[model samples]
Target: MMMFRPIFASLFGATLFVATVLPAIAQETLPSWSDGAAKTRILDFVKATTTEGGEGFVAPQDRIAVFDNDGTLWPEQPYYVQLGFILDRVKTLAPQHPEWKTKEPFKSILAGDLKGIARGGEKGIVDLVMSTHAGMTSDQFAKIVTDWFATAKHPKTGKPFDEMGYLPMRELLDYLRDNGFKTYIVSGGGVEFMRPITEKAYGIPPEQVVGSTILTEYAIVGDVPVLRRLPKIDFVDDGPGKPSGINKFIGRKPIFVAGNSDGDAEMLRWVTAAKGPGFAMIVHHTDAEREYAYDRESAFGKLDRALNEAERRNWLVVDMKADWKTIYASEH
Candidate 1:
């Protein structure tokens, strides 16, 4: 009986030991991020939130993190994927319309004159989207996106559109999840377009994504109720609209937010303004050889205002040329 008592106590002790150490071991085995101040701050923030007795400790459910998609999660040049989708749509639909052959933006797109298409500016891009994406049911639009992402390839890299995502950002997303953060993507791109592919690319489910949306309505298509996507813009999740969308959709201020341009300034401001600990990071594209580099003068993802604000606020500005060990995962 005495020997049996000792054996039971040892087994109980071993069980306790495993219970205490298993989680730590699991955390330690997470992918190693680069050794830099940005990585250090990220790890420290996670530890503070997840570890008991830490001042920044937040319950797992409240550990919300938001990211901007285009230039943040993935590459946005030679152009945004949504733009490519629209261009393809223009090409496909041009035969039906015929007038597009003479239309300014559509004409440039059809002629493979990207510079001319961009010359139409943001308004040009918006016109292209409205022309191609509007007048379709939401289900029909979703099918278009699903089909395009399946076959679309980057012009320069010749990789699937899905493969153009930044490798380091993907690792950051996983790291946050490992630490119990629920990540959301808030982007200026069309919500429907992003929702179709984000889950596969970012590990963020569709429900957690926020972006520009068009008005939708319920309709009965042949006795089956269906939600139809309308072209009337409901919201544009860019700049200040990013913060507005976050509040409307998430209902809670994020503890972590990351973006890459002036379009993200308001979102970072909103997140950093939270009562307690928070992190705001900006991904600065500076590696021209590995990836395109543009900031103040670039037509998209311009960083001037946000860059200054980040510097003034001591927020992390990820130098693509310096901080990242690798750019796109495919490059590695």
Candidate 2:
């Protein structure tokens, strides 16, 4: 009788809690999102997955949503924020590495020549990252990233880089989290670089971030054991790597995935291809007024293959110009 009484009370309490919470979920959701198919689709998915005894209902622990950091959550146009960090780091470290003045990528970087950096391609960028991001301990690198974000401003918006996360997307993150979904940033940007500001910017913690990373070596600095950053590529969490990183870190396939470029194709493909009811959305940079709009030919955040795939798969494509009433948070 005692065991039965306790179980009945627990069940009654859960029912009463759901009775009060479900209506709130249905009513107040994504206020920043404009009225459109994109908004409707997102709400529908959340409802289906969150409602009790629904066919698409997902357990709260299983309700994982992954998002690409660049372009999707924030602007990655003109140049990637991490690349800018590397350039700044180069200038700061130039006195230590005197030969950088004569080096190819370093020479051009010091001269503030974006054209030369572009010409250096993936290899040049990797070189720059290795030179600037490496050689420091992991803790030191994290401090450098946090310090950089304190002052770095977006060239176009003139706002601090940390202040440039998309308003609608930030709202979506909060909405999903409020609806029992765990939001994670699965980006091609550096893991260390993104970790410092992700918590403040997106409400996602550093532990939930997965991104490209460099190898680090364990060392003893006096009495402290430290992981010193090495100038070697450990992982590139872009394209197919996104899914791999997601699986590695989150240990579960996300039911919802948001991305802004072809680099995120495989991640979306992995998510939507799963057996259950899944949702995938691509952020099409259509608003030239609020943000930069280049897809196929853009050096950063190229949205070609993923754009075509989204259309063919009937996935929601968010038109920044029409769908989002405001772009940046400051706009609101």
The C-alpha RMSD in Å for every predicted model, in order, reads 6.5, 9.1
Candidate 2 lDDT over 186-219, as tens digits, reads 9999999999999999999999999999999999
lDDT tens string, model 1, 1-332? Answer: 99898899999988988889876767652233457787888888888889988887999988999999999988888788788888889889988988888888889988999899868887887787788777778788889899999999987788886787788888889988988899999999988899888888888899999999888888888998888766567898999999999999999999999999999998998889879988999999988998889999887788899999998888998888888878777775
Clashes of each: 1, 0
- C-alpha positional error of residue 220 in candidate 2 after TM-score superposition, expressed in Å: 0.9
Best by TM-score: 2
The segments of candidate 2 whose C-alpha lies over 4 angstroms from its true place after superposition are 1-28
* Backbone steric clashes in candidate 1, count: 1
